[model samples]
Target: MKKIILLCLTIVLYNCNGNAQKTAQKTEQKAYKVSKTDSEWKAQLSKMEYYVLRKAGTERPFSSPLNKNYKAGTYVCAACNTPLFKSEHKFDSGTGWPSFDREIKGHVAFGSDNKLGYSRDEEHCATCGGHLGHVFNDGPINTTGKRHCINGVALKFIPKE
Candidate 1:
């Protein structure tokens, strides 16, 4: 009976090891790709935009001119000018930064952020490997606990007439 129990334990260990190996392989496959060269992106973006998006610098919270903007329009990528968020999706998170409940579908990508040891959602530009900001779960309950903590430098607002 001891030998049978030992065999069962070995089987479970082997299965767990295989699962770990597969997870590692999958992670390697999904590695973030730096699609644009640093110089290329710099040439396309302004100094402030290049710093915030490429260098992962944060803008002053609650200081963005768009934070109080309530007009209907679209916010586009400051670097690539890609449409990212609609004015309709914008909300006051009172967190000092312009917060959005949702993004323009397929414009941003989500990744696991473990920088500070705590796990949080990270947002990145789908076209460029630019760091937009982090997303939090403490947003309005009506819309999913999704807060896109975006940098003011990373976006340019186009007011709708």
Candidate 2:
């Protein structure tokens, strides 16, 4: 009986170590090395944008100037300048945040987010791993229930001329 218990403990520890290693590897692949200084980012972004994008802060819901921006444009990553969301995907989720139903292929990555102690999809810049926001399953039923709640500061809208 003691031998069996010892074997189980060993297996649990081994699995835990394996999981930790895998998590580390995944983080390494997703992390973006900062090449720009804080001053540089500040210069490139407005004070509010810098606060949300660079500092990983969230803006108050329904307060963003872009919440109602319904123009045709491409939404790009504020950090790495990668195009992530298309105008067609943008929708008003009525949650006071910029919502998208889809993203440009290969530009955004989704991961399980438990930031608020609940399971949700966390959206990030695929190339830069910058935190954009979380996704939920409470969006429009005509489309998928997926609501990609994005931080305005994490995006740059480029309107088509």
> What tens digits encode model 1's per-residue C-alpha lDDT throughout 67-128?
88778999887776778899988998887778898899998888887768998788878876
Residue-level lDDT of model 2, residues 1-161, one tens digit each, is 99999999999999999999989967864445445667888898777777776666788998877789999989888777889988888898888889998778787788775667888777878876677988778877887767889998788889988
Off by over 4 Å in 1: 1-35
Clashing pairs in 2: 62-96
| Pairs of colliding residues, candidate 1 | 62-96
- When summed lDDT is taken over every stretch of 10 residues in candidate 2, the lowest stretch is 28-37
Task: Give the lDDT of residue 59 in candidate 1.
Answer: 82
* Backbone clash count, each prediction separately: 1, 1
How many backbone overlaps does candidate 2 show? 1
The TM-score of predicted model 2 comes to: 0.72
Estimate candidate 1's alpha-carbon lDDT, on a 0 to 1 scale: 0.82
